[model samples]
Target: MNALEKLKILGESAKYDLCNYVSPNLETYASGKIPGVYNSTSPDGHCMPLFKVLMTNKCSNDCKYCMNHSNRKFERYEYEPAELSRVFMDYYNKRYVEGLFLSSGVFKDIDSSMEKQVEVARILRDYGYDGYIHLKILPGTSYDLIKRAMSLADRVSVNIEAATPDGFEELTTTKNFKTDILKRMKWISRLSNDKNMAPSGQTTQFIVGAADESDEDILKRTNWLLDKFKIKRSYFSAFTPLENTPLENYESPHPKRTSRLYQADFLLSYYGFSFDELVFDENGNIETEVDPKYSFAMNNMDLFPVEVNEASYDELIRVPGIGMVSAERIITLRKRGLKIGKLEDLKNLGVAVKRAEPFVKLNKSYQSVLSF
Candidate 1:
């Protein structure tokens, strides 16, 4: 097949490797007029168009849920390092995409496979096409190759498909969780401390609901990853069974499960909440109906009705409906001798008044009655 035809298949294959984090759901690609062009959002919520495509679909590993699993039957293709570099440059010159996100299945051994991906980045950098590039650091990739990839690309990632070793074994038997995944993550973390290597830092992803793991299981790993590796983000891809694969008949998770996981993740990463602060059901899963913050407030009612005028920044943020920015605004206003006298005044500062009413008192006046 020609390059364009190969791009169509490879681009579709690369969709599951998320590069953007959108709320309630993960949307990696925008509605582009052409193939391989995706809209990657930044931390500041700016939309940056990216060329996301895989190097090849050929694999030596057996990931049961993957479309390109080694045992699966389908057409497979790959791009020579220079070939992909040219394709990306063509798109870059046309302004079709502002960045490149390159990933691939293991066409051969791990190091050789990783080498091909690194070569593409090397080619791009040598050609003076430096804007944004995110390269996938395949599991078990050698430390030297990892360093080379990081030196060229702005960001890199390793997919921690399962939270625990047994859960990982359930998904793929060929790879070792501790040796292949966690060790590589540690290498990236250590390498990332250098300012010149992967300046945007590293990220990771988890496949939710595929294995017999709970939301708590995922969050526990997330907490560890954030603290241990200081990863930029942890993306959760809800497992969808593909036809002709081992998981084809397996049931998929409710979309809300992944959505709620993202909400809880934010609380741990952005909001000042530990894993213990989150409210989970008896089964160790987060309640899908209510957000984690609201659930925490409802469960611990005694902490409610905190006086907005007197509450510290931490306490104000813990109140339901008060965000980091809103809490900061409250503190700033109070420091200026401007007390929050009414619910309307809090709303004007971006507080979700309905959610906050039961939890907050404005200038010594309780706004609403608390009820279970």
Candidate 2:
């Protein structure tokens, strides 16, 4: 196939990985200067169309839910290192994209597949192209290659795919959850620190609801990864059954469930939430219809209504709609002896006072706005 045809097939094939790392372009987003989707920042800072493609779709592993798994019958394509570099440059030079997100299916072994990806990156850098490049570290790739890949790429990642070992085995027989995937994550974490490379740091993805994994299970693993390995980011790709794949007959996971997962992740990472606070149903599932932050607040009612004028910064973030910025504003105003006079004052200061109403106490007496 020609380069365009290969790009079409490979790009379509790549749409499933569901890993997102692009920083938002807030300035022109409302006016529509940037593309709505697939736009991200390079490790070096340009924010626009990120050229995301897989090196190859051929695979050695049979991930049951995956469209490109080994046993799945489908036409495949491969991009030689030189061909990929030229194609990427064609797009880059024309200003079609500002960064590259390169990933691949493991065709032979980890090192070989990873090497092809590395060469694409090396070729880009060698051509004096210094935009952002995000590369995926295949399972079982060597430490030396890991170090090398990090050196040439702006950001690198090894997808945990499944949070736990046994859960991972249910999806693919070819990969050992710890031996192949987790071990590589450990290597990247160590190498990233020692070399000070991939300044955007490392990230991982979880295939949510695949292998019957619970939302709670995903959160626990995410917490552990953040605490133990310091993974820069974790992405969730809610399972969507593909035609002809082993899981084709299964139900696709809810998109709102995936959204709720992001909210829960934010609460834990930024809002100082613990697993104990996020109420899970009997089946270990988080509530799909509600935002996890609001749900967590509902469960811990006594903690609220937070006295906005008196609550600490940590306490304010836990209140449903009071974000970091508004919390800081409230704190600064309070430090200046500016008492938050009314709901309008809170709103003027940028608090989402509507959501915060039930959770925050009025500056006056024990009665809160929620009481009204």
Candidate 3:
């Protein structure tokens, strides 16, 4: 097949893996703007840029949720080590991309497949290609192979597709539970902490709505991963059923629910909210109408109207709309001794006080009462 045809077949087959990383534009940076200073039409639109790409779509495992599994009758293709390196370099040379994100479907056994991935990365590095490279470290691979892969790639990931042991067994039938996946994550975590290791760090993806797992179960596992492994990020892919797969008839998760889980993950990482606080009931599913922060404020009415000047950082973060940035601003601005008589004062400093008022006290007065 031609290059275009090969790309079509490869990209189509790889889409079922559900890994996504979007690149950012550097228009503001070109003008010599300082880092962390973002220019956006709206205040909330500021974020750093990234670049992402898939590596290959060949596999030996029969993951039920994956379209490129060995049992599935789909067109298969594998980019040779040199060909993959050339493609990435071509993109980089033309300034069409910023980095390479390489993942595969286990074309051979874990060791051989991982070796091939490392070979591609080695070629790029030897050619002096300096850009971000995120590689997927397959489960059951040797510790030595993982170490080698980590040495060349900037970021590494191992997906734990299911939340529970039974859920993992149901999805990927042949893999061992804790021994194969969790053990590798533990090793990666250890390696990342070492000062000489790659600086970008490690991340993982969990397939939501593929099996019978509540949001609470997923968040609980995420908390465990973060505490135990010091993971940089945990990605949640809303499970999309593929044709001819065993789970083709399964119901997919609502997109809004997936978005809320990401929001909840942020709350857990930065705002000190527990998985239990984000959930409405014992099952741990977030309310669909509002995000978890708003839900938390509405439920804990007793904590509202906290004094902005005197409230501690922990207390300020619990408020419905106040994020880490706004909380710091509130603390810093209060020290200036400005006469903050009303909620509108926060608007000048770019704080969303409309959402904060119900949960904050201004100048020792509870200006707004919680409705629920």
Candidate 4:
């Protein structure tokens, strides 16, 4: 196929990887955004637009939840390293993209597939193109190959793909939960930020809902991964069943599960929240109707109305709508002898006052204003 034809097929195939996406609500961004224009935050916290696509969609593994799994029937496509590199350079030169996110469905073997992806990063660098690149490390790839890819890339990931090994075992026949995936994660952690290695560190994704795992199940693993590996971040992809896959008849998960997971992940990674403090319903899942922060605030009603002038950084962030930046701003302003006895003053400091009103004591009369 020609470049245009390859772009059409390969581009559609790669949408399943939501590594660059923080939210699935693209309808809100659909009108303003165009193809290959994805806003992904980098390791240093700069949100950069990426040119995301797959090296190939041809796979040998039949993960039941994957759209591009081997059992699925479709027009398979692969991009030669040179062809993809040239295409990416064209886009980069035109300023159509700021960086690249390259992933692939495992084809012949883990080594060959990973080499192909690393070659793309290598080729771009050979062309004197220095831009941000995030490469996906195939499960079971060797450390030598990983080291080579890490040298050329800013960040790399090995997709955990499921919440737990046993849960993943039920979803796929070929993958070994203990050896193939986790061992590779350990290798990445061992080599992170080493000489000529990926300075940004490692990240992994877990497919939600596909393995019949709850948000709590995902959170526990997320917390452990964060605390143990000191990994950069986690990405969540809600299980969307595709036709021709084994799970085609399975119901598509709500976006709220993805959204709530992101909220809880931030609370775990950034704000100081424990798994016990998460407000899960009887089903052992987070409440999809409310943001996890709001749910936590409701569950801890006795802790509400925290005095804005006195609440610590952690305490301020625990409230419904106050973010870390805003919380810090409140503290900075208070230290400047700014008495924040009113809602307007807090709002001026960047707090989402409406969301914070019920949870904070702006003043004794502030809570009564909304009767909230």
The candidate that achieves the highest lDDT relative to the unseen native structure: 1
By TM-score, is 1 or 4 better? Answer: 1
In Å, residue 233's CA in model 2 sits off its true spot by 1.0
Tell me the tens digit of each residue's lDDT in model 3 across 190-235. 8887754656778888888997888888888889999999877787
Which pairs of residues have clashing backbones in candidate 2?
Answer: 22-40
Per-residue lDDT over 1-372 for candidate 2, one digit per residue giving the tens place of the 0 to 100 score = 887778877776666554444322121221123221255544355556767788999989888888888988889889999998998898888887777888899887878999999999888899999878889888888999989999988789888888788789888888888878888888888877855578778888888877878888889999999988888888888788888888888887776777787788878887888878887889888888778888888888878787887899999989888888899998998889879768888889888777888887766444454533
Query: What TM value does model 4 have?
Result: 0.93
Off by over 4 Å in 3: 12-51, 369-372
**CA lDDT, every model vs. true structure:** 0.90, 0.80, 0.72, 0.81
- What's the residue-level lDDT of 289 in candidate 3? 73
**Residue pairs of candidate 1 with colliding backbone atoms:** none
In TM-score terms, candidate 3 sits at 0.88
User: By summed lDDT, which 10 consecutive residues of candidate 4 come out lowest?
Assistant: 23-32
Q: Please report the candidate that would top TM-score against the real structure.
A: 1
Candidate 2 yields a Cα-based lDDT of 0.80
Global local distance difference test of model 1:
0.90
